[model samples]
Target: MDRIAFDIAHLLAGGLVLVSFMMIYQDRLYALLNVFALHAVLLSLSVSWQAYTQHAPHLYVTAAIALIFKAIVIPGVLHRIIRQMGIHREVEKVVGVGVTMLAGMGLVAMSIVLMLGLTEAADAFAREDLAFALSVVLLGLLMMVTRRNAVSQVVGFMSLENGLILAATGAKGMPLVVEISVAFSVLIAFIVIGVFLFRIRERFDTVDDVALEDYRGEVE
Candidate 1:
């Protein structure tokens, strides 16, 4: 039973990393949002599995927050915002898909090597989960840096937070308060970024970060 539980948890954590890769490759805003929603769904499942295997019930609240907010509400809101802004069909890419994917693979390899070296004494489950979490976080950063749209950057940031949540749940005896704080922080970030998106649109008539950079006299 222990081995089975570990395998399931490992698989779910790996799924999150896979979804993060998918997010990096998406050039279209709508497709990216959809993939992020899928990412959040995978995270919720991963957290719920952790809760079950560790017998940590408070993790369920964390899972529920991921499902309701990240999976559903955030995506729905972002979709509507894109539609209203008339940017649903737009595609933005600062780097080629091939290059981004290769870089992501390198980051994953590095994460695995680093985690394995640093966590030699940790449990196998935690070592794998932390490695995957780091991969997801790095991929999210790559996604943010390679995208020109504000919405896509927001998606990247949220995906990065998903990785943090995954790592937290993987650790044994993480407090409920810490999980709740993380969730609230993400919610606040979403709200702030949503408003910021609107403001950018209002001023520049678009949500392209490169354009905003130019407007601010910043090198792009």
Candidate 2:
């Protein structure tokens, strides 16, 4: 409840939202991966700050998981995947960048207004974190929907999970079991996506999901 603690939490949460916008703005696959790595690093710092402020040792574990797995392992795997798949071109988008940016701004505005109105009695830091986390989640979803490439969509999904972690650590009494589950879930999802990437590339010879639309079989 200290003013300084509130300010720091707000700043970190706001950085997550800002990075979500950066992801939406990135066109190149490698650039988007770099931004996603930044996103994970911010999430780790935010969680560590939460641990320090809340005096929760378990959240530090969460922060380490974010730093180690998300920031280091996942991005490395993704870079390798891109290299192996020869998908070094600019990411194709289903919509224009300007329109997507407008939509992302609108999502942020909606999340702030909605979370603020709904959590009036919550702690100031929690209220701000929830608002920003919601914005990150929305922007991540927007990225997934707007990008035609599978790997970029995977990055969006990971970004969305980072928002969920921010929300969990911001609020009180999240079980370590749940945090572990979430981390493992992301790993499992990455594995599944990696397998699918290879399979899709083998069959379609491309990871751009848009191309699959033309090959869809007609319903009998």
Candidate 3:
């Protein structure tokens, strides 16, 4: 690949990682949801650039899917869910912001080291993309574990899926059918999770996982 293509891809992938960090750093549910939207937008742009550089037209459809469903539709739905649930206060964090940020930095470093070592035969763009993608995925998982709010956890899950799509598009010849299947599966998960969130709120009067734990303890 040319220098320009490589640099653009690097920039977009790095932006996704940055947005993932932003999501974890956010204390409010609305802020986290906004950052998640930005993450999806970055993922869509990165995939579009990948499609251009790789000369794969099918990947454009994947980009569209990310842009439409993830960036716009999903975030909009999440905003409404939070509104209906009346959860506009700051979300409870299992870890401090400083600790979570330090952990995220460590995850990014580990991903870079691991991907570079394992993907020695891959091209520079692919290697870098995979590294950033893994970083985003790890950060998403970290966010999910460190946030007590159910809505925030859903955002984390969606961000993790963004990373998976990034890695898939970065590698050559990922089947469009598989990408479609993954997208649909995510949509299904979103629907299920949304329903579950409302149910949790209805039962416990709060959308925090701790309520579920308490209920389980009582049942036991």
Candidate 4:
């Protein structure tokens, strides 16, 4: 049963990483946000499964945070902000999709090869978790680099934090790092989103980051 549970957690974590890859490949702002929301939900499930495997009930709290904040509230707020600002369309990409995807594939391969070498025999779950976390981290970076908009960059950053949380939880004993991180990320995510949304609105009258950068104060 323990082995089976561990395998399930590994599968879920892997699924989350795959979703992050999809997010990297996204073009539209709404699609990116929606993919991210799904990514959060999958992370929650993966964490909850990890909790079940490790017999740590506190992780349920982490899962709850992921669901409430990432899956529901964050996306909800972003959707409303986009609607209000009338900017619900594709964010500009700095690089072409094909090139970005090729880069993303490099990241995913590096994650698996590097992490598996580092934690070769740690355990069934730990090795898998590390690989997935690394993948998520890389995917987030890819998303950040490929997107020209600040809002999309923020989304990528938040998703990177999600990967960090996954790594912390997968370690032995449900460490202090995971618990503190969950709380810290929740606080940071909400605060940053609120501030950015306003700044985005104030400058461009839209949540589009490309426009805001263009509006940055210039010599008269």
- The candidate scoring highest on TM-score is 2
Model 4 C-alpha lDDT versus the unseen true structure: 0.78
Q: Which ten residues in a row have the lowest lDDT in candidate 1?
A: 198-207
Q: What overall lDDT goes with each candidate model?
A: 0.81, 0.81, 0.80, 0.78
Alpha-carbon runs more than 4 Å astray in model 2 = 176-189, 202-216
- Model 3 misplaced stretches (Cα beyond 4 Å): 176-189, 196-198, 202-214, 217-220
Candidate 4 clash pair list? none
Tens digit per residue, CA lDDT, model 3, 22-49: 8887877788778888898898899899
RMSD of 4: 3.9
lDDT of 1: 0.81
Model 1 lDDT tens row, 1-220? 3888888888999999999998877767788889989999999999899888788888888888889888998888778777776663555777789999999999999999999887468877788889999999899898878776667777888899889888888878777635564666577466646655655342223446675677678874
User: In candidate 2, where is summed lDDT lowest over 10 consecutive residues?
Assistant: 199-208
Measured with C-alpha atoms, the lDDT of residue 194 in candidate 4 is: 72
TM-score versus the correct structure, for each prediction: 0.86, 0.88, 0.87, 0.84
Please give, for residues 13-77, the per-residue lDDT of candidate 2 as tens digits. 99999999999989888999899899999999999898898888888887888888788887887
- State the number of backbone clashes in model 1: 0
Assess the local accuracy of residue 129 in candidate 3 as a C-alpha lDDT between 0 and 100.
Answer: 87
Candidate 4 per-residue C-alpha lDDT over 1-220 given as tens digits, one digit per residue, 9 for 90 to 100: 3667777887888888888878877878889889989999998998888777778888888888889978898888777777777663777777788888889889989988987787446875688788899899888887877676656777888788889888988986856855676676667667556755565642223435565565675423
lDDT-based ranking: 2, 1, 3, 4
Q: What's the lDDT for candidate 2?
A: 0.81
Inter-residue clash pairs, candidate 1 = none
TM-score of 2: 0.88
What's the true lDDT of residue 39 in model 4? 91
